[model samples]
Target: MKARWIITAVSAALFFGGSLLTSLRDPWFQNLQRPDWLTFEFLIPFIWIFVWACATISAIIVWERSSKRSRPWYLMGIYAAIALLTSIYSPIVVEFRSLIGGLIVGGLATVLVYILAFLVKPISQKASWLFLPYALWGPIGTYLTWLLIQLNPGVS
Candidate 1:
């Protein structure tokens, strides 16, 4: 029980921290190109919430199935890998700002989340819930990335 709580808390913290760190790096964001509707100030908090929500839900599902030996770690690894990829590519792609590129990244992220859902059978139904929030954020992030690219067409 206590271990479950710890895992949940840690997972939430990782999601929140990763989001916060990314927002803080916005000033260093390389491209000026953005859709008129896509403002960093507004979008950052939204992304943070979406990311946190996804992590929270996923953690809860994991906690509920704590008895499973390999499932929790597998889920954690999947989410972490996806998060890490987002963090790494976000800055670079945003700096370069291209619609097609953003689309590809966004599509990949969505597919990965879906794959994660299928991979974890222990809490497939509940875990499937987490994927929606992740999916929602992927498109928003992709849009922002596309906007950045459009605004900075010359960014190489």
Candidate 2:
């Protein structure tokens, strides 16, 4: 139990810090011409709050739903998958500046989270809690993607 808590806390911190660092340092991210509606300065804090809140709620849900016997692997797998997919899609979505493409990727990711929630039947309710913020962010991200496409129509 103690180890699980430690792992969760560490993982959450790493994920949050890594995201912040990337946003702060990535040239492509910093140089991109964002739409008027998409403000990075404001979005960063919002994203940080959202990520931490989701992580906390998800950790609680995992503790309540899964046993020590299986929780670590489950949590690790979920977080890893999310990180991998986001890493792959984020740059492409930004670089390509395609509204449809970004929407497809973000939409699929959102759907996958919902699907995972259903698959974990015993914890589906709590899983929904874990993913609700992400789900909400998906549409906002899609909107930003669309705006990016509008702002940089020639990018691809």
Candidate 3:
């Protein structure tokens, strides 16, 4: 349906748009110490694209199948919270250069994604599974962020 597509597009746009607005390029980020295993830096954006697509689709599935009163409020509240929390990552991590802040915000984002996954399950199992990748990846991201913070003590 058109609504589903619209939601997906808008969700994707909001995520990527927020990234554009908040993302910063700095020598600090570039020069930060990373393990040899963490060398695949070029794939970060692509991974985010995939994760957002999955989360968006899952949210749409939940919205379509849930009660009529789920729109622009209950669902939107969760979605908005998720978006806002996610958007907080770059600013705190890059702008303020706060390691603990990044960990906390990233941790919150992970929790929100899990909550989104749970919210979709009452609607569609398949849709719920769509968020699985993100759910699975969130902790990994949080861990890596923590490690990066630990590994690089001089990023600020």
Candidate 4:
């Protein structure tokens, strides 16, 4: 029970931390040309909250279901990796103004999410389902980053 609490707290912290680290109003971000079809900015926060919640639940499911196996740790490692990569993405794009860096990280995230899902399937199908939103969102994020790169040639 205590371990579950700890994991939940840690996951929440990572999600919130990653979210708080992103600032889309900065000058660099403000200067970038948004795609004409990019109308989802308003919904992004809500979508992320949903995705993060699902991810947390999925992690907990894995923790409980795979307690006897080594897969849990490896699975959690991938989660942490995705979190770290995601946390760095905004900083790379906004702080360093590197769209290419964002693209690289976002693409890797997309790939990792799929792998995470694949690995978790044997442990718990329900947990794998919970990751559906995140896995789906990954490509959207990667494509957004790619679009940013195409639209903002001035950014290095």
Error of 3 at 54 (Å): 0.6
Please give, for residues 23-126, the per-residue lDDT of candidate 3 as tens digits.
64666666778777987678877787788778777777777777776553576567767766676677787778776787887798889877767766767898
Q: Give the Å shift of residue 40 in candidate 3.
A: 1.9
Better candidate number, 2 or 4, judged by TM-score: 4
Residues 1-156 of candidate 2 have per-residue lDDT tens digits of 575576567656555644544443456555657866554566756774675467456655665667757664665466556544544454445455444665676666666666655555465466556677776676676667666666666763
lDDT of 1 by residue, 1-156 (tens): 465577656666555555554443555453354466554565666665677566556766765676655557766777767665554454334454444654675667667877886766456567677777776777767666666656666652
Better of 1 and 3 by TM-score: 3
CA shift of 32, model 4, Å: 0.7
**TM of each candidate vs. truth:** 0.66, 0.63, 0.85, 0.91
Q: Which stretches of candidate 3 lie over 4 Å from their true place?
A: 69-72, 154-156
Give the top-scoring candidate (lDDT). Answer: 4
TM value for model 3: 0.85
Task: Sort every candidate by lDDT, greatest first.
Answer: 4, 3, 1, 2
What lDDT does candidate 4 reach at residue 22?
72
* Comparing 1 and 4 on TM-score, the stronger one: 4
Indicate the residue-level lDDT of 65 in model 1: 71
lDDT, residue 15, model 1? 55
lDDT of every predicted structure (CA atoms): 0.61, 0.58, 0.75, 0.82
Off by over 4 Å in 4: 68-71
Model 4, 41-141: lDDT tens digits are 88987887888788888888888877564646778889888777877777788878888998899899779888998888998999889989988898998
